[model samples]
Target: MITLDFDGFKSEIETPSEDLRIYNFWATWCAPCIHEMPYFESVVKDTKGTNLVFVSLDDDRRPERVKAFVEKKGFSSPIWLLSEKEQKDWKQKLKEDWSGAIPATLFVTAAGKRHFHTGQISEEKLKELIETYK
Candidate 1:
């Protein structure tokens, strides 16, 4: 897992690409985020032509704990730990109305369209969004 500040994260995913990129924002302490882990893992394995990345918002001081959690869950998608400490600064950068919620998802289409969902998303909805956006 790589640790990224806001700028690093933006640079990572903001570049133009032909693939549909899905960034799932989560943390180890967030239960709903944890609950949706397997769904994301399953989708990443079964889906084609799409890139899924898990962005962890866990405390920077506990990098080892975050690594252990991801290892225990056996996540296959690329994982990046967000090191930004101020939610107010980065929340709007992700979305205008984002409330700093966990289980949020940012979908970037090949066509350069962006879709953001804030809160727990069902596996069905997740698949549906991918099909619709990809």
Candidate 2:
């Protein structure tokens, strides 16, 4: 797991690649985010050739808590703590429709296709989204 500030995250999202990428925005305190994590984990285990990145929206002052939570949950996917303070600015950069909501997701493929979803995502729906790129 790695910690990335706003610039690093932007750079990551901008760099295009042939592989499919899924950026899941979550936090330790977000119940919906925690609840849907298992579903994401299950999909990650079964799927191949896809990049699953868990971007934690926890407070910058308490990154240890975020780290502890991820370790406690046994999350296998690469996790990153968002270190940026200007949430509004970065949120717009990620997506104009995004309302800085937790449990949000961004799916990008090598073909330049991008999909953004807000709120808790079900396993079936996640699979369906992934299937689109497959």
Candidate 3:
């Protein structure tokens, strides 16, 4: 897990040189979101050297609390805190059908392609999806 915020995310995912950009939107408060942590971590572990940017959708007013939550849980994946505007903007860009769901994840590679999962994903299935990209 590598820590990144809005600008860093732009540099990584928006970069022309990078390949396989993954964005996982999560929060510490959501149970389902918490449950999906291990899955993303497993993805990071299994897909070493792949580009994955994890962003925290927690309220910006409580960044310290969010940071503490991650620390308490001993999370292995790095996270970026999203501003309210950032969250709203992404929800629109991703899909209008979304109700600003938590535990939402998106994957994009240098090929300028995209993949999305709105709910929890199994480890085996994630491995297959990642390998497909490889």
Candidate 4:
């Protein structure tokens, strides 16, 4: 299991040569995002060697909530609260038409191959994803 704050994401992800990156972008206030977090963490802990990250889309205005939820859920993966600038850049980078939605996930390879999921995810699908790349 890994713990990632926002400050730690880019560097951690960029340092890997070819690891698959499973990034879940979420917010503290979004009900579905909050609901699905523990399941994401559970899969990460159960799997042995896959990379997982949780990027919190909330700003400083909601840090407490984010922190509280992270602790409450006992998340063991990396968690980050994103920068507004970085968030905007990512929205443009991932999809110009994206409305900055929370609970979006991107599965990508180090060389930039990408697969996107725009809503909540199930544990079985996550486990399958981790296995397929292993």
**Candidate 1 lDDT tens digits, 13-100:** 7889998899999999999999998998788678887898999888877899999998898887898988758556888887878888
Best of the two (1, 2) by lDDT: 1
Residue-level lDDT of model 3, residues 1-134, one tens digit each, is 34444555556665664556667788777887788677778677767656655688877777788878878887766677766656656576565677777777777766767777787666787677677764
Which ten residues in a row are the worst by lDDT in model 4? 1-10
Cα lDDT, model 4, residue 45:
71
lDDT of each: 0.87, 0.85, 0.70, 0.72
Output the number of the lDDT-best candidate: 1
Model 2 TM-score relative to the real fold = 0.92
Better of 1 and 4 by lDDT: 1
Clashing pairs in 4: 4-78, 4-79
lDDT of 1 at 128: 94
Residue 132 C-alpha lDDT in model 2: 86
lDDT (Cα) of model 2 = 0.85
The alpha-carbon root-mean-square deviation between model 1 and the true structure, to one decimal in Å, is 1.2
Off by over 4 Å in 4: 1-12, 110-112
lDDT of 4 by residue, 18-123 (tens): 6677889888788988888888877777666557788878775556777887888778777766665466565765655677777888777666566777888788
